[model samples]
Target: MVNVNCNILQAVDKNLMIADKIFRSRLMVGTGKYETVQIAKQSIHASGASIVTAAIRRLQINHPFEEKSLFKYLDWNSLWLLPNTAGCTTVEEAVRAASLGRELCKKIGQSNNNFIKLEIIPDYKYLLPDPIGTLKAAEYLINKQYTVLPYIYPDPVLAKQLEELGCSTVMPLGSPIGSGQGLKHLDSIRVIIENAKVPVIVDAGIGTASDAVQAMELGASAVLTNSAIANAQQPHIMASSIQLGVQSGRLAYLAGRMNELTQAQSSSPIIGISS
Candidate 1:
């Protein structure tokens, strides 16, 4: 077999995973609303995602006599399930959920390298994170040896605080969840990225492939999205599109950029050398 050394292949090998000892498909997706679990699995496969987030809640427990479990619907070996404290509105709730996430992962035969996707949203209508509560929860979880990746506003100060508290990464919202606003906080996102020592993932509010590309181009380490891909007319196609977009955007950022100028380029006859 001929060795294929392409950018796509390189990205698949290099940028596809993270620092938390997890092998990911690079494009992080969510286990959310789909017509069926089969559809969700297909979409995740098409998106080329190795890291999929799921909510860790009491409501998701399998009832007695249920034929199929949620784990049965996907290739668990190929994916890292990041449990989130989705409905948490306070520090206590977030911490409790994180503990439960670790326990559940262990029970499911996952490693002790516990990684929790932390979210503490006090506002029911807006679903914005309670920044103070999130910070407190992050501090507690990180101290307890959990790799915390909290979803928060695009606030650089809060990001710094999280880093100081030993968070693995900071996941900032591009806009509101399911808003499809496509990086409304570009400036703030840029600031967070530039200042972050750890990975900065743009989570939520990404509407399309271009949005993912733009976020990566702006120096975001990764993008975590759900509604944009899961609710697409054709989820599989959208997943593929997002996977490509992230790779393209990351390449562009690494390849460097050109400076813009007011003057137009001189094709010929500008000075001399007329043949």
Candidate 2:
């Protein structure tokens, strides 16, 4: 056996705080659209993500197959379950879904059940989140003492409004959901990250590992990805790659990247070099 240096791999102090809960991993994966629960579990475990999102609409209360239940494969002790209102089209529906999700969590004995990923997308064609309805639902949920993470367009003004409304985090989309466009509204997202007091998470349009890195380098507190990994040929490997990408981006950000220059400059000692 060869001796290895473990100090180099020591954990960094990059804890993500949402409401009162703390998570060490910044990458949040979705448990949807996978071929099987085993694949989803393996991918999630390989990704090293502490938080995973589940669609409340898809979760079956009474199913014929026990393996089909998400709870069956997940290690509830380690992973934080973030139930999302994926298909809700209105404020009322979203609010009800959130409440039901909380109740389900309670029934399942989950500790952090008050967290919700609020989404209200009435338009099916574009699948764009309805900002007005999202705001309304967020306000309602916040009033009800829920730690709401509202998904909205990459609009700085709207992000600020959500922060003002006491949302735990504001998740702005890079592009439309599942489009994999990869940060189409970079300027708007930058503005939101710069101005918002709460955490900013890039919620969608991540096509690959580079997309996740770009989002993190742009100062996003975390990133939530679903289709990118789920649709991959080998999801478990993709998940691991994405986790590395996120880690690299976060380290780069913490290292204070150099400023961009208009012209190139040489790094040699001109006086010592021969003419």
Candidate 3:
């Protein structure tokens, strides 16, 4: 008979699938907040992320697939492009941005790529996502055959609603945008993970590798972060660290963590001696 642990280990090593696309790496990096284009490029390389997201407006203003374009820095054939509607506040604006993002993807030679990272944030002070608007935009995008990965609050109800709406993934925020608070709503996120039919991606609020690890350990399908890697003093190194942390957490999850106990147990029990 086959060993159970070995069988589980093999199964755990399988590639991640999103909307019929297979990705070897579970980490997704963003092309924003880096001090320089070169640094961002290097960090992407270091992060081992198969999916790379770019703000649609940022791409349009910065050459839009020209020789100096950020897309020019990486191999488009290898790295999947995820166009994001970061600056859009309303459902109408977000839908339009996603359309523009599709055009941008076509210009970059990813003609069949229809992935969009939907963000609908009406509030500016906290930069929290607007759930109703996000759902509206997601419905529009999914109807248009675009793979929608929505950034939302870690509300289990909202998560289930999005999944029922046919989203590719429900990206529940760990904290506010670029806040680095590191899974502030972890308990809610855990509930989402437990109940989600689609993948649960912990997006934003990841300050470092430990944050990524915790998300993975909690059974998050993946972790998406731009600030943690881009804003680091050593971005490339931080990127690598996050990559390792994700791997470690995934392995630990697969191995199955020991159950927590109210009482402590000795690692090695001693034989009773005559008292």
Candidate 4:
């Protein structure tokens, strides 16, 4: 078996799969819904995550001084921005969104090969990814020399398909988006992780520190969380918790786990009775 290795763990690798590089951070964060950009930056720093997700939006210049860029306040040296096609519902839309992201990144003096978080969600309420459409987008983008990291359901087959299409990584939701329900499809996630040729990132529905730890322990390459930490009373502290959780999980996985037992064993000695 190929052993995992990183700064936080000995046997588990926390390297994030960007276009052609492997980033050494397992904690991926979103740049959304923060009270302020400062707070968001602080939380990101606290999380110790090297990669942060950014959404691609059309250029709307309401005012000359109006800052519409999310990357304005974030520390670029420490964090690599992973632009996402969050609101796209179709393959065409997703492709356009990713192109827009690439353009925007170039306009802002960022790398062109930055990874794209392909999120094709048709339904507004559930926010579930359109897996078929996502695959389409991934195929196109990968062909176009873009680093694609698609967010989809915990489907092992989908992961394999993405890998074959030359995607850098596949992000599967732990549960519904923003639900904070933790890992429900844990078994499926394990299957995806086990079979994937690329990195596997646990994307959404992570509520607490333990949730992140659980995902990492199951051999997931990394995790992306936002609501659970950003919505907390103390977001900075919560970010630290998430960082620790990722580290803890990676360490535990490296340490290896005890097998589950079907029956309980008697600890007390029954030597006299047996004799």
Candidate 5:
């Protein structure tokens, strides 16, 4: 058996609060896009994620005999089910989806069914979230006593608005959904992170471990990913690496990173060195 390091365990700060629920892991994984349920389970286990996102879609009644439901694979007791309005284009549709998600969670014995990841994506090509629709939906959900976590663009003004509107968290995309382009709007994301009072979660466009690390380093409370691990050659390994990367970045942020300098500074003593 391989020896485990106790120091590494002590270094990780595993407490994360989202919508009144405490999650041990900072990384949230998506349940879609995996090859199989077993593979998804393995990846989720390796990721050490306590929260998993699932899209709100109609169950196929035609194939009632076949086991096609995603819920069958999920362990509701351990993982917090975050149902998302991924394909909804309008505020009305998103609201309906959110309601359905809540009902579904209730059916699954999830008592704390107030959490929802609101996403209104009208643009199919870019898969960019509709800020106007998102804000409208968020307002509706918050009024309904739901803990809304709206997925939005990297706009400081919008993030502030969402926080003011009583959102549990504001999830801004680093880039387009599943683009793996990383933080294309770094300045705007930084602005959002700095200004928002609620937890800022960096969602989407994270390709690998480095992308997740960069997000955490930029002061993101958490990181959500899907395609980056699901599409990788080894999903389980990638998930584990991303988890470690997120932890390292969070530790670095807490430790206080050194300021950047334009010129290189000498490490050795110049007076003692022979010319």
Candidate 6:
């Protein structure tokens, strides 16, 4: 039997790229839904993710005077902050949020960090993003020199359009945000991944590490998971699990899977067998 070595195959995959920065770990965990700030920090550390995305509108990044500021607890030097426009429902709101995110990054000493996770979520029930609004917001933000990572539905056409608009990465939801439903739009996401020039990071509704693996195995550059880890019974453990899943899936993709057969076949050679 031939021994399979993954580290040797790592050369082909290299690192997860977004704009100019490269991440070793493809599991980008979200900084939300945790019980406490301490837990959130612990989970992030355990996940071993170089990039951590947070909701700019929900979290307090400016109020350093307050006891519960995100900047105070998390170490900026190690982790890259990806400010997300989660609460915005309109193009105008999302664009303004992206601007605020840029200024916040500058103020926090991440002067070159212009990464913004654009989300125009007008759908209150499912928290789905508005494709038209997202496109408009992304176009405006990209013009301002901000690296926009737009959260969109699993539409290959829209993903292509966003890629052409100079958005850094196209984030398509596996399901609804914070729902933990897990990759409901699997086929559509696969098409997006196949056609996308930029990184296709699966953003939401990942309930388990298995789901994360599914997304990665289908050739996603990375996955941004929050509820799957944060809402887990053990957030820190789940975070680590996600890290493993992302790595495993990426390695599997790089290894190149075998072709499928319609019927079962014998493992042993039949023609060469001695009668």
Estimated TM-score for each candidate? 0.90, 0.94, 0.93, 0.88, 0.92, 0.94
Tell me the spans in candidate 1 whose CA falls farther than 4 Å from its real position.
1-13, 20-24, 62-69, 267-275
- Cα lDDT computed for each candidate against the true fold: 0.81, 0.86, 0.88, 0.82, 0.86, 0.86
Model 1, global lDDT: 0.81
Q: Order of candidates by lDDT, top first?
A: 3, 6, 2, 5, 4, 1
Tens digits of per-residue lDDT, candidate 6, 1-275, equal: 12143355366678888898887778898877788988888899888899988777875656642777656788888888899999999988888778778877877678999999999988899888899898888889889999999999989999999999999999999998888888999899999999988999998999999998899899999999988998889998988888878878887887779999999999987997888
Model 2, 111-225: lDDT tens digits are 5579999999999999999999999999999999999999999989999999999999999999989888888999999999999878899999998999999998988899999
Model with the higher lDDT, candidate 1 or 6: 6
For model 3, the superposed segments whose C-alpha errors exceed 4 Å read 1-11, 61-63, 272-275
Query: In candidate 3, what are the lDDT values of residues 1-275, reduced to their tens digit?
Result: 22233344446678778989999888999999888879989999988899999888676533575776677778988899999999888999999899998988888788999999999988989998999999888898898999999999888999899999999999999998898889999899999999988888899999999999999999998999999999899999999889887877778877789999999898875778556
Worst-scoring 10-residue span by lDDT in model 2: 1-10
Which RMSD values do the candidates have, in order? 3.1, 2.7, 4.1, 4.5, 2.6, 3.0
C-alpha RMSD between model 5 and the true structure? 2.6
Task: State the weakest 10-residue window (summed lDDT) of model 3.
Answer: 1-10
lDDT, candidate 3, at 254: 73
- How well is each residue in 138-255 modelled by candidate 1, as lDDT tens digits? 8888778888898999999999999888988899999999998999999999999999888899999989999999998998888999999888999888888888888778777877
